[model samples]
Target: MIRSYEKTDLEEMVRIWYEASVIAHFFIPASFWASQKSTMKEKYLPLAENFIFEEEGQISGFISLVGEHVCALFIAPEMQGRGIGRALLEHAKTLKGKLSLKVYKENERAFHFYKKCGFVAASEEVDEYTGCVQILMEWEQVR
Candidate 1:
């Protein structure tokens, strides 16, 4: 089931984010992800429109959106490949209809996954904070 993110979900959500980030963003240092955990919990997640995917009484995945921009999407490492990310993204789609996000150019799985989900890469730029090239992707519901 998809549900709104609540205060109680912070810890688990950060756990999922950190674990997935390490695996998917191997180009970045693991320490960088560790340093961002608290910020993700205290700052980013609280500031976004977050959705939690819970099943069998556990949160399997989640997505965070700030307006039409998707800020984050992650699934537990053990729980990946089961379409949870797509499910969470679809829930966001139903809410916003049109969505946008930036993906690290090196994260091929994510870039292709977003493409498979109908997002098209519109442009690319270097992220000042990470010194990594990012692709700006957008998806809109067909009218």
Candidate 2:
């Protein structure tokens, strides 16, 4: 049920973003979510492409990428731990090049999830707006 994103998916995407951001705040702040929307749309969305996972015709999760760099991946809280995230990461792997992304250092679940999906921690840096340390990860396929 993976497909390209459409404008109609915005509301659901926003909801998912909010939910994920709240979960992210154990290491940051909720207000960073509000502050980042314009930048996310103007900077991130244009550089990124999105894919939605549908079940029985409803979107249950999504992953967005900027070229080979994943900008976001989220599954509804109720829908998590059911392999949706892994499936999306596996789908990303089938794309034609190396893939990369950043995850909050304190979000251990996400850090481990990406690791399990074959990404390796390549770097770390502080996020300017949220002041949270983030780890940059990458996965590359040998030719």
Candidate 3:
């Protein structure tokens, strides 16, 4: 089941973000993700619209959006490949007529996933946050 995020889900969401980011973005030091936990919990998350996927009463994954941008999407490392990420992304598309997101260029799994979901690479640029080459991708519903 997917639903809007509640304040109580914040901790689990942050944990998923930290763990998933550290593992998925292996090019970045784990310390970077670890250090950003508090920021993700206290600052970034509060500023975005968040949706969580719950299965068997436990949170499995989440997606965060800031305006039309997909700021974050993370599935618990242990719970990946179960369509949770795609579900969360589809939810985002329903809410926003058009969507955009940035993903590290080295994260091929995510890049291909986004492509399969109808997002096209709009550009490539260095991400200011992590100083990594990233792809800016966008998706728009056919009308």
The most accurate candidate by TM-score is 1
Using all chains and alpha carbons, the TM-scores for the candidates as numbered come to: 0.98, 0.90, 0.97
**Candidate 3 residues 84-125, lDDT tens each?**
999999999999999999999999999999999999999999
Q: C-alpha displacement of 103 in model 1, angstroms?
A: 0.4
Best by lDDT: 1
Task: Please give the range of 10 consecutive residues that has the lowest summed lDDT in model 2.
Answer: 38-47
- Rank list by lDDT: 1, 3, 2
What's the lDDT for all of these models?
0.96, 0.83, 0.95
RMSD of 1: 0.7
Estimate the overall C-alpha local distance difference test score of candidate 1. 0.96
Q: What does candidate 1's lDDT look like per residue over 1-143, in tens digits?
A: 99999999999999999999999999989998999998999999999999999999899999999999999999999999999999998899999989999999999999999999999999999988788899999999999
> After TM-score superposition, what is the CA distance of residue 101 in candidate 1 from its true location, in Å?
0.3
TM-score of 1: 0.98
Instruction: List the RMSD of every prediction in angstroms.
Output: 0.7, 1.7, 0.8
What C-alpha lDDT, on a 0 to 100 scale, does residue 53 get in candidate 2?
89
Ranking by TM-score: 1, 3, 2
Over the stretch 1-143, how does candidate 2's per-residue lDDT look in tens digits?
Answer: 88888878877776777787787556567776878776765666556788888899888888998788898998887788889888888888888479999998999989998898888999999988677899999999878
